[model samples]
Target chain A: MRNQLRRPLATISVYGINLLHRQNPYVVAWWSAAFPGFGHYLLNQYIRATLLTIVEVIINYLTNINIAIVYSFCGEFDMAKSVVQPRWAIGYIIIYFFIIWDSYRSALVQNKLCHLAQLENERVAAVNLRPLEFQYIEPKKPWLAALYSFFFPGLGQLYNHQFALAFYAMMWWWIYLTLSRAHESVTLMMVGNFQESIAVLHPQWLLFMPSVVGGSTYYAYIMAREHNRLFRIEQRQFLAERYSHSEVRLFPR
Target chain B: MLVIGTFEHSLELEQALSLLEHDGIARKHILVILMDTDPKNPNQFLSKPTDLYPNAIEVGTAFATACAVIGTSVGFKLAWGPIFSGLSAAVGGFIVGFGLYLFVKKGIHKTRSKRLPEICVIVQCTEEQVELVTETLWKFGVLTVGRVKEPSLRA
Candidate 1:
């Protein structure tokens, strides 16, 4: 039973074992506020992020929170207050604050650990090859990653092998498109039915798209650049160990 | 005597280290600091985020968020409506913000890398052993070598 119950914290696919680095607590908290699970996701706390994301979605839908937020943003406070299911919404409030605090505290602790780990200077296996997966330290261009993300919200993450985030963003992008009727609205607008285009859009859902797209693109670009640096560090460690032994010769014929 | 030398991080340098060890120099007395000049490792002018020195994640995220919010707000009045207008603005804003970030970061990174040692090897030994260590280093195509009678400053 113990053996069967065992689980790995991170893997090459599900959530890669990211390098330790100082992450800003405020940034992590801000992301949590942006989307409950996002801060935990950045911290590489996949399990928590997944759970929080599910709960957030369920609660948001049941409480009509998104609709309420839309009304609130549009300055219809009475409608906003009326649309929300008080009980469900109330439960989410605590979780929202908890996640922000949780992610912030976790980041601070993680930063300390990162400092210790760097001081230790332990070498890592730069290459991992398996029948199903190939992960290696290699150079990747930030610009190219950004371009891919610009084309689609998650393709850049996909390129970076950030499978969990890539898939998550893609799934949400599709959902956003469907709920907002963004494509349909664009089509209507293109065909000269401006009024119909405007009428078709769900502004609440559409508003979420900008932040998600912008964030994803920026994240992908930064990750690419960072990974390149990691590759160099890992490669340097490898070379020092592997190639530091050689015989000297005074003169060669 | 302390023998200090810098090499281009190649096989010859490794050979020199091995020869020094074979010449009865203890491993602990020999130090090697490798330079990051690998051909495959690009991004020579940018570095990973770390404690004091870091690539700012918040700046990009905050900039992107701000752009996204503004774009979305302005889209309410545009002809393409909110969807297309907001998206374009978000992307445009992200590019400008991130690019500006990289420009500043690159300058810092370039200077930091310049200060990094290039395949430096420091050997500590007595006056009697200096000749052997120096001979071994020179035989293997070392870049530059110097000797110090006494060590001082940042030992």
Candidate 2:
């Protein structure tokens, strides 16, 4: 009776594990297309993602990309052209395209590498007893992970047991918040002081917001998925080791 | 004496460490250098070295100083006051110097040799224990093994 109840639970867990293992390369690429460095963040290339984000913000602001975008959207093509400095605009265009292509290529490569690593891990699990008896965490929901990051940049990392990385990200986020006066701007906007809100915001620091938010969201989701998959793998190994040769047989011949 | 060995997989490395521990080797003596093969593994995280040109900063500073001198002289020829001339020249010189530094650094980075192997195990032990350490590593099918000079303790 107990075994019968456990069978369905096992099947559900296996289905969840399969879902966690699969990461769409196109989805990663699309995240990068939406925001530079987001895809790299999803791939767990923190340093590269941070550097690319910094570059993207600096270049985007210097080239007046956001202002031009706003103007273009408002049907002011000439004003958009006028706002952008040609030399910097050219540099931004090149880098923008390069980042997209590079991120897409990297995502594809990393997906393949993850697949290889999973296979290798499975092989190791089959033969090794060391990881079998270790305590394992329950799989985390990707949406929940992303939601945590949306509230605070490093909370997701903290949830993933990356304490040091979480601290670093939290420090940076605090600095960004302070320098950008982001909270003040939001408060002002809410209170109907639109002009003051715009005045309070530092454009240079404000540019960091999209990257930080996007990167954190995507990174949290990816990390949760990867961690969940690893947990499933470890669970399988543990179960296999424990039940490979059960002494008590329930069925009689 | 110091011993270093490379391993392609973490499992083999883990096995090697356990073997060393079983042989009564001190935990302090065994150091695992996790390779940056996995982006998710943040062990020994380091920013990529982008400054490849030797003395890039000094070269940039020297160039800036030279440009400032030239600018000052040119400003004087144009009858600009010393203070205004100095300020403008300093800013212009800094911009030019920074650009030069970036250009040179990129070129040097392109030509320089790649960094060392990412994953390896480093063991610090007495001379007599070196053989045992090497044997243990060999038993676990380490990728490569070699002796290394004792690193300096001074900061």
Top-lDDT structure, candidate number? 1
Off by over 4 Å in 2: A1-22, A121-138, A190-195, B1-155
Q: lDDT tens string, model 1, A1-253?
A: 1123122211233344365555668877877876788778677676788788778767867888766765665567898899899888778899889999999999898777656655555665555676767765556778788778866788998888877778887888899899989889989987888878977887667766665665576667667766765665565565567446522211223
**Candidate 1 Cα misplacement greater than 4 A, ranges:** A1-17, A247-253, B1-33, B36-58, B70-80, B88-155
Candidate 2, position A209, lDDT: 48
TM-scores of the candidates are 0.68, 0.49
Give the backbone clash total of model 1: 0
Q: Candidate 2 lDDT, tens digit per residue, A102-196? A: 77787677556555554444322222123323222455777687668766888887775555557767887887789778778667767777666
Judged by lDDT against the true structure, how good is candidate 2? 0.56
DockQ of each: 0.15, 0.01
lDDT of 1 at B126: 78
**Against the true chain A, what TM-score does chain A of candidate 1 give?**
0.84
What Cα-based lDDT does every candidate model obtain? 0.68, 0.56
Q: Give the per-residue lDDT digits (tens) of candidate 2, residues B67-98.
A: 44344333322333222343366456646766
The recovered share of true contacts, given per candidate in order, is: 0.22, 0.00
* Residue A6's lDDT in candidate 2: 17
